[model samples]
Target: MSKRLANTLGIILALLWIFPVYWMVNTAFLPASQSRSTTPTFVPFGGDFSAFSRVLTPSFMNSLFLSLRVTLLVVVVALIFAFLAALAVSRFRFAGRKGFILTILIVQMIPAEALFISQYKMLQGWGLLNSVAGLSLLYVAAVLPFTVWMLRGFVDGIPADLEQAAMIDGCSRTSAFFRITFPLLAPGLVASGVYAFLQAWNEFTLATVIMNPSTKTLPLWLRGLAIQSNQATDWPGVMAGSVLVALPVIIFFMLVQGRMTSGLVSGAVKG
Candidate 1:
């Protein structure tokens, strides 16, 4: 395709993808009546914040806190373990290494639904259901394999000669790795961390099965807004809650975006 045509097509595709997000924000400002109007309003000239205000209830706050706690735990735990596993697989040749790699692939291939019953039973047996720690464990398992695979590529892309060079200059192997290699892996770590955060933050199916009503996460709480009354759905409140739910992810990306870019470029040049 011609360069001009490709650029135009790309912009069009981008707009198409962003339109739903725009509509969501737009609807969040509208009143209940306007939000459900047969004719869509392109803008909210005098939009009210009542919907947003209503979403700030104690229950919502509690659920938001729970979601944050679980997500943070998942990211920290998953990244630590995945980083180590990736380093080992990429740096060392050992017995069953291939098998271990194959196992990660096989686990990824298996559908999550297939293991729901077993997962639930295991957690129940361990007396960990409806707790942040329990939910974090499941999130770690779900996110770990992909993260290991991703970090493995990063580790493999990094040349071992740099670490060896540092070691030859009187640094210990551990010191050489930390000083010379770990810095290069920052971008990979950040990217993997973002993945873990999103997975843990937005995971609904597993949370639904694992958590009780008293320990509901943000997604579950959002679901509650929809079914608050049997009479009708609260579209406006739901939209507002959605906007709230998405804010952390957007803000997080914004906060780390510069670091992510720097890491990517540095890793590329170093590798």
Candidate 2:
């Protein structure tokens, strides 16, 4: 009875969580006239596509490209650095190792808002403001520490014996690590990459401060849509833009979902 009750509660919570998403999608298909109606239109049968049409402007396209570039760069670069750092910490002992780990923790502890002034100045000094590279650098810094910490746990969880056995079987240390342990870390890598992707994609405050008007990301562009006119906000257009913005993330997960699921199950068994 308790188990059934728990399952019922879980389903309720899941529905509650997904309600906003369903509403956004429903609103996107709604006509402007019906979008703001006091009674909600839960279904969008025979709804107009004008909102989506309006959302596909050149400015929106540019923002979409910029966001994609920055997000991909952040995910790739953060994953590489975090992988190396995690490997070093988990597999080898070196001077100041504890201090290095402590520093990662400390960096994560610092509020991102507090560093805005300094980060802005640094990027400005480097003349990277309003550039994809500049935004990517900041995104990497923001996500790297957490990625490293998460990957390190995965690294530590893998038995050293596996790598040693491969080495004993005529494999070089580097070869053994890549051929054996690296494959095992796939789940961790995917999980961390997802986190970094979401962070870089949805991040607003830093992007607003760093990017110029011409180089706004998708989130900034969405904000612009909300306040584009002095007249009433275009709720339908905003919802449409939101749906478009989220499509890439959904597609990304779809592509990697199988690998991620297998990795999770493998990691659980290993753990």
Candidate 3:
């Protein structure tokens, strides 16, 4: 295809992907009566923010806060542990090194749902149920293997010679790594952060298993909203809640995208 044609096609595809999100935002501003109508309304012409109001109520806010806390905790803990693990695996060889990487792969292969029973039992045993720390610990475990694998790739992608060059110039090994090679891993960190954010944010099964009445996450709260039949399925409110849930992810991506793009470019040019 010609460059112009490819650009047009890309734009078209982008619009196709964005349509559903746009529709959700549109619906959230609508009243329930308008949203539930068989004939769909493209715009909330008679727009109202009542759905948003309900979506941000104290109960929903609690869920939001819980999910955000868990997501942030998972990202920070996962990144620190995964970054170190990635550096070790990439920079040094030791007994069981291969086995360790293989174990990460094996862990990823296992279904998350399969671990729910054991996870619940472990949390219950530790008296961690219905707690943010409990839920975040589970999320970190769930996300760690993949994040490790991801950061390993990034670590490996940076040539050991770069750090060696810095070391030859009288830099300590740690300083060489921190000053020379670390900057190159920004994209990797951002990518892993995005993955951690999405996984923790959207995860429901583990949350549902570990968190009870007082510790509900956003997904759990949304599920509760979804299951209620007598309330006539407040589609507007649900959509609003979803949008609110999505806001953090959007903001996070925007904040990291610049660094990610720059890192990609730097890596490409260096390669």
Candidate 4:
């Protein structure tokens, strides 16, 4: 009985959590007339693709490409650097190991907002503002410290004995580490990549400060929906734009979710 009640409660909570997303989709399809009406249209029964058509512009395409470029770069760069650093700190004992770990923790504690001015100045000095390279650099910087720490835990969680055992089986040290351990790090890497993806793709503050209209990301283009010069706010168009902005992230999660589930299960069984 308790289990049934808990399941019911879980379903209810899930539905509640998903309601906003449902409404966003609903509104995106809703006609501007119906969307702006006092009565809510729960399901866009008489809706059309007008909202989507209106929202799709050259700027939208540019933003989409720009955001993709930045996000992909950050994810790849951050995962590579973090994985290496995590492995080094976890497996090899070198000088300043403790200090390196402490520095990572300390960097996380510092507020991101505090560094905005300096980051801007530094980017400005390097003539990288309003560029994909500049944006990706900052996103990687923001993501690496946490990613390294997270991956360090993952590396530590896998027992070193496994690698040693592989080494005893006529496997070289490099071969043993890769064949025995690297596969297990998939879940952690995907999770860290997801974090970096979200940070780089949806970040508006840095986008606003660093990019102009020519290099606007999806988030910044979405921001432009809020106000139209001498025109009334197009609520339906805004909602449609929001949906488009969210699609890449939703699609990315869906694509990686399978890997994440399988990796975790595989790692657990192997461990």
**Best candidate, TM-score:** 1
> Model 3, residue 244: displacement in angstroms?
1.0
Backbone clash tally for model 3?
0
lDDT of 4 at 6: 95
Return the clash pairs for model 3, or none. Answer: none
Instruction: Give candidate 2's TM-score.
Output: 0.85
**Pairs that collide, model 1:** none
- lDDT-best of 3 and 4: 3
lDDT of model 2, residue 137: 91
Q: Which regions of candidate 4 deviate over 4 angstroms? A: 1-19, 229-231, 251-271
lDDT per residue for candidate 1 within 126-225, as digits (tens), equals 9998988888988898888888887988899899999999999999999999999999999889888987887788889899999998888999998888
In model 4, what are the clashing residue pairs, if there are any?
none
Give the alpha-carbon lDDT of every model: 0.86, 0.86, 0.84, 0.83
State every prediction's TM-score relative to the real structure.
Answer: 0.86, 0.85, 0.84, 0.84
* Candidate 2 lDDT over residue span 107-166, tens digit each: 876676889899999999999999999889988988887778779888999999999999
Q: What ranges in model 1 sit over 4 Å off?
A: 1-16, 36-39, 251-271
User: Tens-digit lDDT track for model 3 on 237-270?
Assistant: 9899888888877887777676546544433111
Clashes of 4: 0
